[model samples]
Target: MSVLLVLPIVLPLLAAALAIIAYNHRTLQRIVAVGALIAVVADSVFLLLAVERDGVQSVQMGGWPAPLGITLVVDMFSALMLVISMVTVLSVLIYAIGQPGVDQDQPVFHPVYLVMTAGVALSFTTGDLFNLFVAYEITLAASYVLITLGGRREQIRSGMTYIIINLLASTLFVVGIAWVYAATGTVNMADLAVKIAQLPSGTQTALSMFLLVVFGIKAAIFPLFFWLPDSYPTARMPVTAVFAGLLTKVGVYSIIRTQTLLFPQHRPSTILLVCAGLTMVIGVLGAIAQNDMKRILSFHIVSQIGYMILGLGLFSVAGVAGTVFFIFHQIPVKTALFLATGLVEQSTGSTALSKVGGMIRRTPLVAALFLLAALSLAGIPPLSGFVGKLGIIQAGLSAGEYAIIGVSLVVSLLTLFSMIKIWNGVFLGTAEDPTLRLAASEGETRLATPLLMRGATVALVGVTLAIALFAGTLFDLSERAAQGLLDPSAYIEKVLG
Candidate 1:
């Protein structure tokens, strides 16, 4: 049974090799990629259920002892993250397949994308700090290929910024790992949790703050997040959609994992609260300023991350559970929004607010999809976003965190305003030119979005609604996960034993 723990990481990698071998046949490559993701999604659901049934599940690679051999672990949090992330990427892959033309190395796209998937799986499941770094590198390396896949001038420009920034973060991650190992005598997270508590209070605090910055940069939090809005908008819509949906969330997952486990202060963290406030305000403001559909969505990705950090700052089970639920909401909603924008670009030919309009008449289904996702993103009632924001706000109020909660409310309003800007500019108003000459087909008739693209977007939207409709069950799961995160003795024992 424990052997199944490795499948999440191994399946994509095995498929990636197969994808490379099938370069001569695009049909076979597509089959390989899609089939592997389906297996992963099924496996992820199994893992989540198993973790729920069985408590924390962990194993040592090559049968080595704890704190000596490689470890891979799955708790409620990891399992949930795995499930959501896999579902999101699967949607993005389907969306990518349906994109009829532009220019991308289709053969290489399959392998590189699967490698990124494996890296993301590793990030969620690895039990040690060093391997986590390895996971990040693997993900980043694949991303470097993906962001630049088409070799466009814009893609290359943004891809360079993305690469240089992540490389620096990767360097700092290594340094932080070195410091942790030198201080704690083990890189395994469960062991580090035990030993880190034994260190000098001063040392613990310093290490905590230092690693926060390292992962913060990766997570695109606050001042460190400047690279993201600029970087994400330039990639192919599918690439941007997947990156928006899953990659930064991986960083958030890292922060939640390491901070709760390694630090475990069990109270409000002033530093995290401050960072959250700043990230929320700044990111929304950036979104408001953007005239492009992709940029606006990209900026909101930064803003929404603040809420997750806000939940973490409260350092309570309720707060973290809210954070967990929010992560679930963000993964699909954000991906859906980006994809809707991609659809807009496809139909009208440009994402710039000044150039495109009246898409509601042209592509009503896509327009409806965009509005549903937009409203969800803005925390409207009865949607998944509303529930996530409410969970965090209630947690904050309970923790007497009124100031940050107020900031969050303001940010929510601002977020709604920016989303409205997109709706007005892209869907509601008249196009700057009715001819729609910018569309790929080169006539007044806009490009017809593929059935697969529409189907994939619909699937994601359905996921969001399902999350909202089943909020109670998901909240129960997130609360359980948060409880495990709060008191990780169960996690530590499962790993170290």
Candidate 2:
């Protein structure tokens, strides 16, 4: 059982190595990616069941014991994140294969993607603070390469800014780790949680706040989010889709983890609550200002990040549980919307609302998928997004944070307007160029939408619908995750035993 804990990270590393050697063979790359994705999905199922049946599972590395070795712990929270991350990456990988302009002959993209998967998995599983930092760098490095893959001018420019910002954040992370280690004399997360209480209050406050800012940078909090919109829109479609889906959330996850594990204090709570309110307001306004599909979605990512932080700020069982559920719901919906937008770009040659029109008539299936995801983003009923938002809002109101609640309400309403804005311009309005529409109708020159791409969209839409339909079970699972996080001795024991 413990051996199974390593498979998610190991499998991807192995697959990436094999794919690197088979770079010249597109078919081989495809097979490797599919195989890796299947293994990840299978691992996700096994982890979920293990947590369900046996409670949280932990594995200490190299036969060492707690506080002395690297540990991989799989609680309900980690397992669910693993599953959601797998689903998003797998779908994006499939969609990437279907993308029109991706050069499969270059092994760099697929291998880097696998490495990124491993990084996310490791970040979720690791019990050591330094190991988490290492995992983050591994993922960040891979993403940097992926962002700059095409060498387009915009990609290069955006990628440079992305690298600089992340590098600065990484430096801060290292400094925080050093400070934590100096104070606690150990780098293990579970150990730090225990020793943290014994530290001097000033030391604890400084270290914890420093760590929060570090994670906040990655999470794209209101003031720390300037790099997101500029950098996100410059990546290739699949790259942007996957990044939109998972990367920033890694930061959010870290914030939740650190707050719950090491700094469950009023100071962190107060700061996070204020940050959440501001993030919502700032992100939505950014969205309102964008006319491009990808850019708008990119800003909304920051907006939604606020919701997740709102849960963390409340520091209650319902709050954490709701946040966990929201993160899970957001991953697929965000990626699916990005993929739909990519398809629109593929067929219409632009993601600008002005350049894209009549998508509902031109590509009905893709348009439907986009609308479903957008509605989900807006927290509409009968979707997973609504369930998650309801939980968060209820938690917020119940906690008597009415101002935050009001802000959350405003953000949601503005989010709806932004969604409707895209919906009207791209799918409802007339195509600005009649000749382009005429060219679109001519079968001889019509852009061929691949079956894999369509299948991916259908599959993601199914996930969104299923999550909505089975929201009760999902929320319960998140509740269990929240409980596990609140009392992480089980995680520490498993990893360190």
Task: Please write out the lDDT profile of model 2 over residues 258-370, one tens digit for every residue.
Answer: 88888654247788999999999999999999999999999999999999999989888898899999999999999899988888888877888887788898788888999
lDDT by residue (242-301, candidate 1, tens digit) is: 999999999999999998899875333998999999999999999999989999999999
Clashing pairs in 1: none
**Segments of candidate 2 deviating more than 4 angstroms:** 265-267, 443-445
Off by over 4 Å in 1: 102-104, 266-268, 434-445
Structural similarity to truth (TM-score) of each candidate: 0.97, 0.98
Backbone steric clashes in candidate 2, count: 0
Q: Relative to the true structure, how large is the alpha-carbon lDDT of every model?
A: 0.91, 0.89
Please give the distance, in angstroms, between residue 50's alpha carbon in candidate 1 and its true position after superposition: 0.5
